[model samples]
Target: MKETVFLTGAGSGIGKAIAKKLSADGYDLVLIGRRLNKLQETATEINRPSECLELDLSLGSQIVTDTVKSWIQDHSENQVIGLVNNAGQFLRSPFGDDQDDWDLLFQVNLMGPVNLTRALWPHFQKNREGRIVNISSNLGQTPVAGTSAYSALKAALDNFTKCLALEGGAFNIRVNSVAPGLVDTPIHDFHQKDDSGSLQLKAALHGMHPLSRMGQAEDIAGAVSYFLNPNNSWTTGAILNVDGGLSLTSKDP
Candidate 1:
């Protein structure tokens, strides 16, 4: 039987890309997202058997845990062997923004992964093998203006990845993160309202990287596949920067 991977935020962007890559590589997928229709759409594209679940990760810890448990129970035959915490909310706001915004950001970007990982940890422990790949951002390591909340949360996530790796080492559960630079995805649509603005913004972002180009979702997905592969089994507690050399540039204006 093929191993299964539970991926959060599988409806779009990096999450969707990861789903397609993993499916092609012969893993059954349990795709989770807030939009049922979008999740179903993604499921249809994959050749491997997949299940879609509608979940709002930011809702609460109990709800997230309960929902995941239910899925595990239902898919007992597949035997989940991997998890990708790819779901995240990117809210660009100044430091003095409303407190509610801060709370929501943490809940979605941080707590959601924490809750789901905690819920699935026992299964990994029982199986004596598992892989967890977190979708982090370069912003987590390099501070950028107007993304205080997102940067902070991702920073915390990176640290959390290391901590989990240390704890799960004896159990053979590998935990790692992939931090990508600016990628061409709908996530940037909020800033680029028009074609002209998008073109300018794309140029500026591309200029920030030494590669002279922004990243594609497939670029990040490739790195994720590397970590997920059992052949690359010795690596853990590592943060792989799939940023097209963006981290090498100065963060100054």
Candidate 2:
């Protein structure tokens, strides 16, 4: 029986890369994202029995929970091997300027992952084996100007990931998180436009990281892949930094 991985935000960037990597390695997939086209594109690329669920994680927290229940019920025989709560929202509001949007960021970044993981916990326990990987960000670990709300939400997620791991250890469910630094993705484009910055500013941000280069989507995906692999069964509640060393290099001081 093939392992089944239920992944959120499996439409682009790191999420998409993870999907491809898992699919290539022969895992059945259940993918969720807001964009149907992108989801379909990912499914097509993988060429496997994949379900692309179009869901806005920010709007339907309960729905995410319920949907996972249904997915588990349907795939009972196959091990629901892993879950990657990789969907997120990045807003450029300076903390309190846009209350509603900031709230939505928290909803997608933190609440949705918690709800979905909680929903899937029973299924993971039933199998006595599972992996949960949260795709966090470097901003969550290090301070970033103008990203107060986003950073706070991600920090909450990191703490939550830790708590989940501690609880899941006895059940053999390895829970971990990966924090990506400056990744070349659409989220960067969104922030650049919102920040009114030149390309050089973005390049400078990428250069500050230890590798002195923006991380590729596959860079983060590889970390997630490692976490999902059953060989690393003893590792849980670990937060890995895939940021090219940006957390060590301070842009402010």
Candidate 3:
């Protein structure tokens, strides 16, 4: 059976980096994302035996679960050994301004992963062997003011990781989470150019990390790879911080 890993958000930024790293490590892929074009680009870049699934996680449990279950059935030949719940939305709204965004965040960031993982549970249980890695955020552990909603959801995901680990242990499934710091991913809008203001902002963010630098996508990917590596099978129920000391700073991004 072909060893395969299903990865959500496998299109750009950190997800793309993770996809590339996993492909290099010899796992065939099932790239899932909201944008088919972007997912296709990632598949082309990796040039591995892979498939793409365009899915909107916020569409509710029935749609997400039904679609993922059907896809798993169709790709049964490729033994799915891992799942990376990396698809998430970031929100930054202060106080009263975030009511609507909170609803959206709960639906997308929290319920999305919840439903998707539930869909994969049966397959993993059947095999009695599987690994799951959640791409959480440093904000979950240490919240910044405007990121209240996002932080709460990520914090919830972290708890879910531990709970899943406890339940999955009987089936030989390991569940872990990687909480990344301020990585120079596409999420931030001001980083697109070398404008003076952007440069200044970067300098401040760098200072937030004791390492005196912003994290690269590869930095977070390395941590994810470590967890996914079969040699570390005994490790589970962990929430690792892959920050450049940014969590320690506890500064607002």
Q: Which candidate is the best by TM-score?
A: 1
Model 2 residue 193 CA deviation (Å) reads 3.3
Q: When superposed on Cα atoms, how far off is each prediction in RMSD? A: 1.4, 1.9, 1.7
Compose the digit string of candidate 1's lDDT tens values, residues 23-72. 99889999998999999999998898999989899888899889888888
| Backbone clash total, candidate 1 | 0
Clashing pairs in 3: none
Reference-based TM-score of each model: 0.96, 0.93, 0.96
Task: Report the lDDT tens digits of candidate 2 across residue range 38-123.
Answer: 99999988877898888888776578877777776777676778889999878766655868767788788888898888888888
Q: Give the TM-score of candidate 2.
A: 0.93
Candidate 1 wrongly placed segments (more than 4 Å): 194-196
Q: lDDT for each of the candidates? A: 0.90, 0.84, 0.89
Clashes of each: 0, 0, 0
**Residue 233 C-alpha lDDT in model 3:** 96
Candidate 1 clashes between residue pairs 3 or more apart in a chain or in different chains: none
Q: What is the model-wide C-alpha lDDT for candidate 1? A: 0.90
